[model samples]
Target chain A: MAHFTKATSVHDWLDQRLAIDTLRRVLAKEYWIPKNINFLWAMGMVLAFTFGILLVSGIFLLMYYQPNVNLAFDSVNYTIMREVEFGWLWRHVHAVAASVVFLIIYIHMLTGIYYGSYKKGREMIWISGMLLFVAFSAEAFSGYMLPWGQMSYWAGMVITNLFSLGSLEFNGLVEWIRGDYVPGQAFLDRFFMLHVLLIPLAILALIGLHFGALRIPHVNNQDGEEIDFEEEAAKYKAGRKRESKVIAFANDFLSKDMFVVSIFLLFFFYLVFWHYGFAMDPINFDPADGLKTPPHIYPEWYFLWSYEILRPFPKDPGLIAFGFAQVIFFLLPFLDKSPNAVPASRRGIFFWWFWALVIDMIVLTAMGKLPPQGIYSTIGLVAAVAFIGLWIALPFITKMEKKV
Target chain B: MKELKILAIVVFFTLVTYWLVEPFAHSQMHKHVESEGFTYKDLPALTKKGDAARGQELVMGAGACVGCHSIEAAGMPAAMDPVTNSASYGVNPPDLSNVGALYDAKFLAALIKNPAHALKVEHKFTPESGKMHPMPGFYGAGGDIDQEVADMVAYLQSIAPKVDEITPAQAFETACGRCHAVRYEKWTQIGEKPSFKKKRDELVFETKLEDYKANLTNYMGKLPPDLSMYIRSRGEHYLSTFMENPQNLLPGTAMPRVGVNAEGAEKVIEYLEDAGDPKRAERDSVGVKVMIYLLVFAAAAYLWKKEIWKDLH
Candidate 1:
């Protein structure tokens, strides 16, 4: 409705029509980030960069990937790896990115928790980030099916069978989800669609919501100091940057992010080239056989903690615990009742709680990969119970903390 | 100090997880099997050296190796085509061209005297089952049994090409192609199919295919799994050990101990990697370049970050 200026150049023309300049200023140029944050703060950018790599490499894979169960295995191992030039590079990139992205997400989430970044006003950022995590998990699970390997078929069977609701006899729900009695053509087709298109769309939307949510509250910092972003940003804009506790997100914060990302990429490509065997499970090299199961069946490393939670209990209880692990993370903002937004190191019992939770998760993840026999079973049960106990104790412990 | 502590915690957890998942869990699953008798040290014939010329004569005459297998590289052909051999034996007899270069010498001698004993598959071929190995054991046609086996071994070894010269494909064919088909390589268990001259020949071909499968299933307990992806699935170490002694992994496995020596096993594994994971070479080479590029980029990025942050207080 307002008068539009005459176009002077390409960007100016778009700015007049689409408010491009305003969008840029709002999104990047004027966006204030805390200066006290460490390299861990760059993990979100790393995750986003990894997602971009996944999208590009996945598209290349999709060009040759067959969704039919009959051809999926051959298409991936033979056609892509053998016939297509540099096909292996794209595959290693996609596989490694799919795996490494989870590692970065965990770091980002832990950094959030350690600094109480999910407190009060920053709840939406944490919630949206959690949603992105869920979307990514779905994407990874579906993408795993595209290979149609032994682990793919069995892991899909195990996970989808969970939807049968134990004693509830809701198997129809699982069949509906799989689109078949077993993971066959129908299942592969639907999963392929989800992996390539549907879940990625959901992830892109969630990523937008996550970034948008960060805009309102700004970012939390290491010392959990209550930063006056408005004041600091003004000082930064007025060239009094030395005393300012904030920096513009454009070149200043981005430079730091790029530095971290380059290092992350070094680690990532190292895996892609020499150590990609871990990402591509040895069992998965065998094409999916409905009759033959591998000696050991487990989900990828990222899901191992929750999987261990499910395994250490009886059917219904295990399902309940598994569900608890999945949903409890979303409730973190409401669960921690501390008034302080300080890092865990200064937060009395929560410091121990933070370390205990990290160690418990590591144990659970390790236990998940192990065969549930002898000592591993006992250790797994303890870790799983401890995980639930930790969450239940979080609110009580935080409520007892004195306001900083 | 806090960051260092965090890094230490991360590294410690990573190593712990790796140990638990890979090594410790693997040990729990596959308790190491003692391969004490796999070398055939108990067989006196294999322990002694023999004359290569006598060995060649035994193979060409009394040993009857050419009855089922074609030592084509050594200028000998089987009595029957692959299809015919597969129909009769339930699996195509592999060409013996690379066997000398691929199999352990003791294993070859033991296999010749007693196929079931060498493979540790005597349990499957027990007299009660009324089942026996397709190849009849040679006892020494009016000669010393040990001397005859020793001569045959020497002959086979003499005819064998240098171990390094044997390609991975040749190694795989000699070691595994009889039972396992690598469809990616267009290599089938029965080798080449015979062309049908008439409608009855087509039916006969189908019958032969069915007979071959049935025979393999009866002999091996089940049809051997395709080796197309086994290199990726079972891995190099598992495959090597399994080849050395199948019963070590699966106690009742129908797979006979092929007795592939260390070098032979390496070649077979190399071939499997080629068929299953052809991109490995490219991945390694490209990975190194990518690592170098990323290192340079990271160094530049670090410098840029330092420069930008120098303006900050």
Candidate 2:
């Protein structure tokens, strides 16, 4: 308490940089935004907002959620299906929000990547966004096993086994995460805490940092111009007076973003209300039966790509060689020599970014949908190779030669 | 040059993260065939082989067994040791002081997998092990048992128990102590019965037909079934996994969540998966080998992509 001494005048004696006023000022509507940023920009906020909804809905579910493996399934069913009146709604909202968050975040990521959002001063924002994605996945994995369903149990089993593959005396890894082998009461309870508490806390902290990094100055247009802030502020104030418009969240930006939000909300709402939320598969309702493996168990769609990758690897086949040969995306920062980033033409290059994005999403989606091995695995190999050669390396070379 | 260094550093870190997290490589590098849809990475063979000696230290000492079990130490007071995190989770762990000579690895695996399944198989236990605790089926019970199970199993095989090196009569006395305390008292009254050991044998073998069938009526019986051949037939670590969730074998059984740790289940299953079935065992090794190879290939590929950054260009 003593450390938080009274502020010295308008400034603090301490070095706490962002007071509420400063935060508000930084986010002021009058701040110059990129003129050409279209509906695609809405996705970043949509990702953040949906995540916020997920956090709220998740908390409600957590209040009644139990992690006792024996009771985990029953407890989930009682609340979502029986006990709480709007429990189903809360549960469905959480489920749908999860899907929505992923959709928005993935598209947001593609937007940032293609447009060089990771370039220049914006690298930290991209990094934070990636971190948000990883944390969100952690949150999802923890929660997926909370219901103690067959898929949850089997999924946990399959993923956990990946740790011990080819020795490395990796059983300890499972114990470290699960606090034991197999997903049990102890494992589920800890996972529940991580899903509901720890990851969310980490995500909020990272989100704060993410937006902070986003507040860094943005580069403008194909010529790499800077926004003249003082001139823009003067123009904004004059226009405010001429129109006699007082900007309130409701009166100005909300009115516009509201229409966009309503459109997205309508689709989301239609899906939730009309179709039943994504289901806990029938087989999963029964507890995990180890001796009796399920006939066909697949991971959730989001993990399909990675799961596909794991389908064919031999246990002792040199892991580093195979894994490295295939999953090159994890090391992208090294492969390209876009020494000068901050894409000079955010508007004109939209076509290149668009096609690149389309190719990626299509292939990634196809790889995910297909069975993991044989022809499909071969296809994945080919496509991944093609992605590197065509979309990344070739473009980089072309762009570099042009500059030279 | 400065930019290149930064790129190099980024490459190094990305490789490190990828190597640490070989997300897809665990299964994709080989022609792995799982009869079941799921597969395991046949984990790398132990480079530092566990000394059966050090394994002993792990079981009773720092491994913190008593920390999550109903395990009793040699000088345990009459009161129950507070339940372990496992037992609080509802597992009824077997006492370990003299267990070494009593049960083989396979039988022990069942006990280790989940006490409920062990009781169901070894004792044909009808009643629930105890009231439900937070415990649920563990390691062998589900899809996610990992390598730590093998370590714990290795550790379990190294432990001494509450009873070992016993004559059949002594075995009867020790095992039936929980069920026939008064009968045991009467038999030891020193005058009428031939001898306590003799009487115990008679109680075991003599109570054959009517009592054997009738024991089914009330779940608790005077004797646990012979476990000698039980482990023999169950296959490596099969006992443990099956024991973790015995309803897999005997549906509608009364075992409530008894194994707490997936490792506990795996520990038991490694023993069971090994010690039990030898028929077609050598045959399955090929498939297991294939699985191992695939995983290794994936890991290597992942590492290569992560580290070298390009094909030796």
Candidate 3:
């Protein structure tokens, strides 16, 4: 039997019914964050902020955006841009946010890897974050089709065609996904729904799951030091805050997060206003025409690294390597084979492995954008092979670490 | 020190990525066509000045300019209706109200003497192709042909609006609108509204459109693409160079050099940008304010963070 508080005012009445105070304590006030964490930890919050911007801007755009293939191009280029007041601002912000969100995700994921944040107890956090990444990728791909421009049509065509499964001949599945022989009215309509509704709901749920998974293990630190959260939190509550290794997440950690977030917004809006061209491919200015194809077709920059992996090989092998790159990141925790959970710098040969992977990814991304002719083709092939080789070498290299 | 090192690494990687993805890749993809000798030159008629009054008489009389073109700003109307002109010439002869403001003086003189040579479309309009240029060259049509060419250019320069006063939309109308339609601007090659009300008028509009497209295909070997999105598809540099000499980038292209001077080209580019990316100015201005607000918020947040962490350290 629980004793209920006397309902004096609205707050007291709500508190008694909802356990609002306890909920806040559990979720925010008493949630412990390691004090040794750096600004990199704030990327999660930045991603959330970007998603909020996307949702608001997307809703406003949806007011004028026609999902019909014929009208989508004009609605975006003319009605939204020329007729509606500040429609361009919403568009620029949405485009910049879509691209920048991927940058932050990559940083967040890399930070987690750098500090071994996925080790043992925090696997759910990583898995949930990866799920969010996939959700975001899907959301972006679907949103890209809403414009019905050349790149939008062709990219949709190429990506859907990938469903054929090489020699297995699963082209029927491709038609099923597109709802037609080619990307047309049916393709645009379904993608519009996925972009605006389905994927966004999934992303929101995954975000909640990701944050919820973080509560148990708290968060990894810059130094990867494992502090006793219960003891440090107790010490802080008892007024020995200076001696504690953890801090209350409500105000103290939030202030730090806000600081990083503000700085990020400063950079983000700069891109939105002045440097938005990168977000919008110039080739996409042309309206979709099925009869003509662009000379060179490529995915957005965020997907270029994996796209390069797929491009350098024959159809079957390329598909296999592409699949490998996509699934390999999720298997990092299992493949690492090291007992120690510390920063790469302290893990000996893992440092070399980490930098090599990072540089190799950069190379692959650069190669993806280039025309695969002569030297570029050779470079792309080597990088793809090296990427696969590095993952195979991860277990062997990390296993040799003497539990530092 | 550690933070500085990390920042340096991030910046270095960002630069490398940007360089490789944008500038370096662009260079490899679209090799720059040299602009040497592309400008129309060697028209000595332009060097010698003439009387605007005499020029106006030659233009109205011997030049037969009003037979096709309408210098609307100068109160000179076309002899034929726009629809009839499209049927006769395969495209509407553009209103030359802004020709003096848009084209180079030498190019104008050359255009009067030889339309194919001035437009750099001689390759397509060759005798072997059996396609005659609609506008016959006035090279030896009458007495004092050089003086006639010079006088006509002078008269055009006299009646035209000042270069600065002409809007980008007007420049595009005179320069490219005869062949290319910007559907987003509700502009068509015939400069006529697509009728949606009366059945007869709608039929007339449809026939005119079909005739214009068919004639354009027969004349140029293909119908020209709409200019609504060309500014985006082909970037500014590519468009500028391509306009300077179409054959340099796309060999054997039917597109003729319109002989627009540098200032005129700028206006045309501005119009394209307006159509393709209308939000650029708003985005840039609002971006500044947002950045300022963010800077202030970041400063305050940083101070609050410093204050909160002070006791912990």
The candidate that achieves the highest DockQ relative to the unseen native structure? 3
Reference contact recovery of candidate 2:
0.00
Off by over 4 Å in 3: A1-6, B33-45, B73-75, B141-144, B192-207
Clashing pairs in 3: none
**Per-residue C-alpha lDDT of model 1 across residues B1-313, encoded as one tens digit per residue:** 7666866776676677767666776677666765443354554446567788988878888448877778887787777866567667756777777788778787788888887787787887799989877887877767887788888888888888999999887787778877887877776666535566899987876676667767777657788888888887887777877887777788888887778777888888888888787777777788788888889999999998888888886
Q: Specify the CAPRI tier of model 1.
A: medium
Predicted structure with the largest lDDT when compared to the true one = 3
Candidate 2 vs 3: which has more lDDT? 3
Report every candidate's CA lDDT.
0.85, 0.49, 0.86
How would you order the candidates by DockQ, starting with the best? Answer: 3, 1, 2
Error of 2 at A34 (Å): 2.5
**How well does candidate 1 reproduce the true complex, by DockQ?**
0.71
Can you tell me the DockQ of model 3? Answer: 0.73
**Candidates, DockQ:** 0.71, 0.01, 0.73
Q: Itemize residue pairs with steric clashes in candidate 1.
A: B55-B151, B119-B257
- Model 2, range A305-359, lDDT digits (tens) per residue? 4454444445555344235434444334344455544442443443364456445
